[model samples]
Structure formats: C-alpha cells, structure tokens
Target: MKRLILHITVIAITFVSLGTYSQNNAFKGYTIEGDSVVFTFDVRDYSKFTQEYTGQVLDFTDFEIENVVVSGEFNLWSRDHWKMNRVNEHLYQLKKSLQDFDDEFSYEFKFVINNAYWAEPSKEDPNITKAAKNGRKIRDVYNLKMYTAFPKKDGNVHFKLKGYHDARKVVLAGSFNKWHESLFKMKKTKEGWELTLQMKPNIYQYRFIVDGHWMEDPHNTNKTPNEYGEYNSVVDIKEYTAFKLRGYTNAEKVILAGSFNNWNEHEFVMRKMDYGWKYVVPLSGGKHHYKFIVDGEWIVDPNNEVKEYDGNGHINSVCMVK
Candidate 1:
C-alpha cells in the first residue's frame, strides 16, 4: 500500500511540474539598429552584479519562429512612437528616412509582444471597462524620467522600465556616460523610479536591462501605434540650446559612439555653435528635436518636445532644440 501511495505522489508531482513549465511565456526578440530592425532570439542580459550588468547573445538559428510579432519604440512610458517597424523572417526595415533625426535628434528601440492569443496573463479590472484597453500586460524592472527645462515634463514620456535584478540599487545604464550606474543612477519614489540624464546635445539610442531581462519601458510615453494593433515606443533626444540646454562641451561636433552604436568612435556628428558646439541641423521648424554632436560625442538635449507616441504607430519628441 505504501509503494502504491508513493507512485501516485510521484506522478502527481511530475504533472504539476509540467503544468508550471507550460505556463511560462516564450518571447522572440529583435534589435533597432539605426534605420533598420533585425530579428533575433538570443538577446539576454546576464548582469551578475548590481553596479555593472552583463549581456549575452543566445542561439536562435534553429528555433522555429512563426507567427512572429516585432515592433520598436523610442520612449517606454507615454505614447511616443517615432520608429515603428514590423519584423519578418529576415528583418523589417523602417522605410522612413530618419537620418535627419539620427543626424540631428536621437532615436532608440522599444518593444512589446503578444504570445499569440495566449490566455492566463489576463485578469479582471472592474475599473477598466474595456477588456482590450489594457495594452501592456508584462511588468519589468526600471524606468526613466527627466528633469529641468525639458519639454514633455507633463507625464508625456513615462517609462515603466526594467529593473536591476531586485532593485537593490537601480541605475539607468547607457553609453551616454560609459554605461555607468553612477551617472544615470535613478531615484525611487512612491510614484515610481526617476532620474535625470544631463546629456550635452545629440541624438542618442539605448535600451533597458532588468534583472537580466532585456525589455523596453512599459510606461513608454512615445509608444507608436500599429495597424494590426498594439504599440511600440521609440525614444528620441532633442538638440540643445544655451538658455534651454544646460551642460558644457567644447568641440566642433559631438557624434554618438558606444557599445550600442558599435562603438564606431565617429558615429554621430555634432555641429558647432557660437557659445558652445551644437548640432544645428534643419528640422521642420515646428517643435522639433536636435542634439549636439560636438567633438564626436552624444548627449540628450535638456530642452525639446516631451511627447509620447499613440498606440497606433506614430512619433513625437519634446527634449530637443526647437
């Protein structure tokens, strides 16, 4: 009788294990490189320590990728969707010529995916009248916030970003300052995480790493809208002006060069100005974004549009030279 009981217990345990495993989610990934986007399944953030995080590329060559959904964004919180592209078996290219934006303002890739009509992640929210209104369902680690005379300061570009393992101490890691935690160290508050990146003035691109999970901001302000459905945020940094722009840079041009930008050393180019070197490129003349590319360096402009993307695939910015 005891043997029979043991066998039943073992079978029950196995079934439970399998059930738990099946409940997990399978996510595919893609990268936002300049004006192009690439499909990949092997992007992993294996950060061993808090101060510094690590990343590795997983093997996705043999993986069966079907019914794939790929999207990109600039910011994570609000609804700012500057760069919106779909992923194909090979890769989906953004047809729009953002070289002007890249040349002047900066752009970054933000992403979110649906498990293909998968169930179980949904819950009941009485206040949420429309069930489909809930767009972002996944939770992540850290988020980004800007301070000072920058535009979009009115909850326009919110980023419910990924975390640093357990938030033991979360910092915004990026190439703007050697991907160091000290510079972009975020402040935690009851509302959420916050930080201020005093970039010089130039177009910049970056991503968020939470506890090794590579994800875009959940609360992205500039989330782009889509035809089929859903949205993606593309972060954009504007140009800098003396009164509006704070910080200092004494050089001809400041282009962006970092790990994300292949560290080309001469990637972005910042134009010069009278008081300081500025990326004085021609924008539409409305409220536009322009970053300084002084002496081969990239910095976020302290002043510009602070708009988020609508969930329908559009673009907007508020932190650049107008």
Candidate 2:
C-alpha cells in the first residue's frame, strides 16, 4: 500500500510540472509565465559599478558584489529593496506577478549592486530609455524597460503603409500611445512605410500621418467611422489561450465551446492528457463565456472561479483576454 501511494504521488507531481511548463514562456531579459514576470540581470553586461552609498568604484574583473537588488518606479525607486536571486557568479534573477504592475505600460528599472551602486545600461541598447522624475527627464541616466505581460504575444507586430514612398515623414499612431503624433516614426521602405511594435493582444484603432496628413490604412478594409467624420483602421490582435479541465480522467471526450465560436458544442474537441483534457484556441481581446461539454454533458470549467449567470438560469465560465 505504501508503494502504491508513492507511485500516485509521483504521477501527481509529474502532471503538475507539465502543467507549469506548458503555461510559461521565457525570453531574453525577462519572461512572462501566466500572470508572473521574471526579470534577469547579468553582471557581465556591466563594465563598472559606481557605489553611491560608499563612494567606491569597482571594476568588473577585480571586484565582488555581495548583493544585488532591483530598483524602479514599481518600488518608488527605493534602492536596497527587492533583492534578486543569485543564479551564478554573473547572473541574478527576480520574479514578480502581473498584479504588481499596471497593464499596457513599460516600467523603467535598473539593477543595484551590493545595495549601493546603480547599474546603468548602454544608451545604444534598444530597451534602454531615459529616466524621468516629476515631469522632467533626468539626463544621462539610462534604465532598462519592463512591460506588463497581458495581451501577450510571442513576437513583434508589423504595421505597414503602402504607396507613400515619396512622403518625407510617416508616423504610426493609435490607441496604443494615446495617438501620439510623432512618437512612432515609420521608416521608408521600398514598398512604402513600415513600423513594428511589440504590442499585446487587443483591438487597436490606428492611422498614418503622411507628411502631417492623418489618414487611415488604405489597404485594410476593417475600419470604423471616427468622431471627425473620417474613418480609423482597426486591428484585432489575438493570442492562443489554453483551457484545461482537470480530473474526470475516465471521461470519454471533452469539447470546448465559447462565445468566441458562437458556442458550437462539436467544434473543439479537446486532447486528452494524463491529468485531464486540454485545448488551445486563438481568441481576440475582451471577455468570452465558455464551457466544457464532458461526455455529452454541459459543465462549467472546474478550475476557474470566474463565472457569470448567462441570464438563462445557467452559469458559464468567463475568460477575459486583456
């Protein structure tokens, strides 16, 4: 009996580990795993560390760092707080949840050395941007960027405008940046003008400013009328979200039905796993009501706590794609 119990515990542990790995995605500098974000800092990237607390300077080759902490707007720029986990002699890591940050914005941060020095990144780094305080920019202080992981995507989104090759300047503006006129400058390409952004999945309305003239995307037909009587082109970014129904391993089959697909019962057949059943579907941004049909019986998601009354005397699970 003891041996059998041990075997059961091992199987449970294996399924839990597999579930975790399937949900998390890691990239350079940071990783977005479900609602958690992990940030990595490598001391090898810095040439020198200037200690403000002790007025000491240490070179990368000859010095020792006793501790490392992360300071940024998230912690109100408090140095010596938020210590990182030391992975090796040269690497450090920190993890935080998506609840700790505001959605859809980039946070400026820097690594601290031994609770004293501020580690600065090279200005040429793409993720390095200037620091600001009280509405004024702090010149010469460069910081690293951390973004909220919602509306997640694995890659960059490309925006292009054709037939404007002769234009002097082109800018990409929309709800992403509150329609800032000159923030997102598009480069002139052989075909036209183009710009790429690391945007999260959501519906965004955008327009092109060609030589100071605001115009919608001519190549795209998905547009809506604006308050100015003109039209704005729309783009709906979507990401694959996995839904899993745990337990009920004896069930013959499971089907995934959601409002995104008009709640068709037979459309999405879930793949059976050791722990349960799983299905991955690309869904657009916003709230979606879904349920699982198990062996021809309708049921709400067992693991999800967010559910709503459909007003038809039935409760349905809700998934919000931010």
Candidate 3:
C-alpha cells in the first residue's frame, strides 16, 4: 500500500511539473526600452489559431515551430530580415531599435512562424495573439501602428507663401501631414497665404498648392526634389547654424551649398550683411561639409577652421554639430 501511494504521488508531481513548465513558457507580452521595441510570442498559443477555425480542441505540442521572423514596413516588408530568438521552451522574442529612425513614422509588422505561418494580432488583444490570416499576403492589410521616436518639442512654426495673388485656394502639404494636399488649408493674407503648424525640431519637405497648381516656396530657396521628380520646399524648423563667410559682401549672390542640401548651388541664398554674407540654416546633429557660392565660385567657410578634402581636389568646410 505504501508503494502504491508513492507511485500516485510521483504521477501527481509529474503533472504539476508539466503544468508549471507550460505556464512558465507562456508569452509575457512586449517590452519597450528607450528606442527599442521588443515583441514576444508563445508557441503554445499556436493551437488558438486552429481552435478558432475548426471549433475543436487542437493540440500543437507535437508541431515543431522551427523559426520565427518579423516582417514590417520599416524593413520594406522583408520576410527574412528580423529573425526572432527563442527565449525559453516556447517563448520567442524580437527586439528592434529605432534610434536612427525619424521623429515620427508609422510602421506595421507581423510575425512569421516556421517561415510559413504568418501570425497576427487578434482583435481582442493586440499584444497577444495566434491568429494567422492569408489576407495578410497583401502588404497593405497590415493594421499595426508603431511609432519610431517621440517628438522633441511641441512648437508652432509659421509657414507663409507670398505673391500668389490670383490663387483662390492654397494648401500646405508635406511630410508632417503625410503629404496630404488638401488637409491643411492656408488662410489668405494681404501678403499671401499663411498657416501655423505645431511642429517639432526636424527637417520637413513641403509644397504649396495654389489654385490646384503645385509650386515650391518662392521666398524660401531651400528646395529638394520629391519622389515624383518635382521640387518641394525644404524647411528646418529648429536651431540655426549661422554659416558666415566674411569678405563676400560685394558678391552679387552668395549661396550656401552643402552636403546637407545635396550640394545644391542655388538652394540657400545668403544675405549680404554689414560684415559678411550670412545664412542661418537649421542643421541636425552631425558633421557636414559645406561651401559658399560667391558669384558662382565655390569657396570654403573662411571663419571655420576645420576643413576636409571633398575627394574632388577641393577643400570643403566641415561643420560639426553636437
């Protein structure tokens, strides 16, 4: 009788240990640390997918989940880029860093299990799911909203478009508003049309749609070509780096050309001040090579001490930003 009781106790202990192991291997949700976002998945939840469709008890214990990967818009929806790591017996995780990403960009991602099964978030809970759908083969069906980084500041910058007197309607479109043409309408002013947008310290590409005619900002010379081969006015709504070139006061036109603006000769025209020609441009935190275009002659910054060869036999002024 004592041996019979000992056998029963051993069987109970085995079941309890299995139950605890299964519970420990369950998904514990995602984690966010600074610019990194971590996604976690549990292989045990794979049965949920079969149960949802067949309405029957499906055991996934025998099914082998070999690999898991993350595919998303940030990586251009590449299937083989971000492979998840198996943390425990059933738990898998993938951590992605968005430190180099823009201030605010929307992205969508889904997990691929065994390189064949595509798992997505369930409607009930976004953090935990075992739902796999075939419709997700179409990349546009992604429904996850992920933010890369937070904005630095909440400040309103005034954007003005001048000399469009005959325009009946004007709209401001750019990266901030997802380049929506008719989203932010500009108010008509005596000088032209103006709009105040709450913006953070970042570089933005924008254009004015005056009476349905897309045009670059006439007053702002900073412009860049968009994906459509059309020019869009670029604005840096942040702290300015005063690029001054002394002894260029007598020049007809002084332009600020730099790696920041893709070496565009006519993009940034400098103002002829009393001492020299000055151009205040919003430069992000990095090192940049620049030159001054004084009457079509490229010249390095006279005031700047740091200089580097531009691989084209010409020395360029190097500006370092903290």
Candidate 4:
C-alpha cells in the first residue's frame, strides 16, 4: 500500500514539472536579431504584454487589442500608419525593414500596443539603455539597430518667392548651409524667383531676402518666431511629431506649452484651423508633459486622456515622444 502511494506521488510530481516547462517555453512575442526588429504576439503569453497598475496586472486582452504598430524617427514618428499583421491563431507579427543612413544612426522607437498604449522597452530588457534627464530608459536611441537597404541620398529643395520679381536679387538664408546670404542666389522666373538646393535630411529655418529686406516665406504656413520678434519660415526635411488640438476655434489664441520648449507660452503659438489648432514641432524620443493655453486659460488636453499630477495641484497631459 505504501509503495502504491509513493508511485502515485511521483507520477503527480512528473506531470507538474512538465506543465511548468510548457508554460515557461512559450514564445515571448518579440525578438531583435541583426538589422531587423520582429514582434510576435502570442495569445498564450497574453498576460506578459499587459501593463501593471500598482500591484495588479492590467491585462490588454480585456481591451481587445485591435491593432499594433511600430513607429519611430525613421518613419517621421507617424502615430498610426505602420500596422502589424496577424499571422495565425493568437499570433501577430511586424517585421521592420531597416535602412542604413551612412553615419552611426541612432533613433528612438516605441510600440503602439493595441492602438492605445505606447509601450516602451522593458526595464529588464537587455537592450534597454539608460537615458539622461529622467530615469526613464525609453529615450535611449537604438544605434544602427535597423540598417537601411541603400545609402541616404541628398534631397533637392526648391525655394520659391512670389511678387519679388521687381527686386534686383533674392537670397536664401537659414540654419542649413550656414545661413549664407550670398551663397544661394535665386533666379527670376515668370511667376517670381526660385532656387534649388541639394541638402541632406534635416530641419531648416530660413527666410528669403528680397533686395535688403529679410522676410518669411508667405506661402509656407509653418513659422517660428525668433527672439527679435521676427518670424522665420520653418521647413522639415526629416521626420517630426505633430501636435493638434480641436474645438477651440473661438479662442483668441492657443499656444503649445511643453517641456520641449522650456514651457514658453508665447514662443510656440499654434495656428488656428477650421476645427481647432495645429502645430508640428520636432522632438526627440522619450516622454514629454504639455498643456494647451487657450486665450490665457491653462487647460489639459481634452482629447488626450493620459495625464499625471504636476505636483502643483494640476494635471499635465503626457505624451511619448517616439
């Protein structure tokens, strides 16, 4: 009888060991190999992809993850364009093909998990690196993780100025090419004046000089005011994050105040649109806290629900800078 009981106990222990091994061997749903970053979502490990609130795990399955996307500086940080594919039962995958931009390229990226939460690299992840400012490791730029198929080529930017036909000459000046006034001279065209410049991928703040007067590009809607209270036409030749707010058309002015611009309320005034306000600002990867000042009233973003306490008895809207 004792031998029979011992045999039953041994059998139970063997089954338990096999069950634990099976659970542990499940696919983790993500892998970074060579120049490619791959994500494999497996339903068996669904609990592992969830966010932890306090001590409880907030399972993402409850929200019914409709989609997943990977975005970063490489794609100009578009919010919802790169969608992943579901391969099979409880399995989804996204394989990002990288390009080589010549130099030691580094870029920050994030996973738009379930089209709702912007998931950062796990703290325990071996690839995660420490970042400056905040203790958050999400800002760490992945160095050459994704290699481009071809080398980066120079882009041609054509500058045009209208109604400047009467002027003797027009020069292009900005951060690009060292703001040289005499270097880029515009040729007169039937419509106005134009100049084509071959430049690398970058953001440039420029103005057209007609005769002796320096003026912003009237045709371009994007502009940034300088310290001297002058507006400079802004041009983005690379990827950048765009911010938008809606339902404040009646407000006299709406300004984008955030940690990126040192919380300068007047520096980044947003342009009014038919539905609301819009502005495109270049920001590095990581986390950013911001608020909108609509006609002097500081308010959190009505559209963005992600927020955190500002310690001053105010709630600031939070955003991931990927």
All candidates' TM-scores?
Answer: 0.23, 0.59, 0.37, 0.33
Better model by TM-score, 1 or 4?
4
Residues 127-212 of candidate 4: C-alpha lDDT, one tens digit per residue: 23333232242333221122111111121345667665679988877765345566567778787776654332344588888887
The prediction achieving the highest lDDT against the true structure is 2
The candidate, 1 or 2, that scores higher on TM-score is 2
Estimate, for each residue in 206-318, the C-alpha lDDT of model 2 and write its tens digit. 88899999988765677899999999977766667899999989999899998988999899999999999999887766789999999999999989999999868789999
lDDT of 3 by residue, 1-322 (tens): 0100011012110000000001121123444443466767777554432322223434555767788777666676566787889899988988766453445644555666565555544454422322235343432232344431112121135566666778899987777756655657887878777665444345667787888888776556667887788788776544457888888666899999999899998889999888988888766645789999889888888788899997788889998643
Q: Which candidate would rank higher by lDDT, 1 or 4?
A: 4
- Indicate the worst ten consecutive residues by lDDT in candidate 4: 12-21
Q: Which stretches of candidate 4 lie over 4 Å from their true place?
A: 1-239
Candidate 3 error regions (>4 Å): 1-37, 42-63, 97-105, 124-136, 139-142, 149-322
Q: What is the C-alpha lDDT of each candidate?
A: 0.31, 0.69, 0.60, 0.56
Q: Is candidate 2 or candidate 4 better by lDDT?
A: 2
- In model 4, residue pairs whose N, Cα or C atoms come closer than 3 Å (at least 3 residues apart or on different chains), thus clashing, are 98-147, 98-148, 99-147, 99-148, 100-148
Encode model 1's per-residue lDDT on 1-322: one tens digit a residue: 0100011012110000000011011112332233332334221221111111122223333433333222222333222233334454444323332232332233222222222211111113111111212235322222111111121122112333333434644445443433333334445655445553322223333335444443344544444554436443344433222222334544444553322334355644544445544332322112343333444344444454465543454433333332
In candidate 4, how many Å is residue 100 off? Answer: 23
- Candidate 3: worst-modelled 10 consecutive residues by lDDT: 12-21
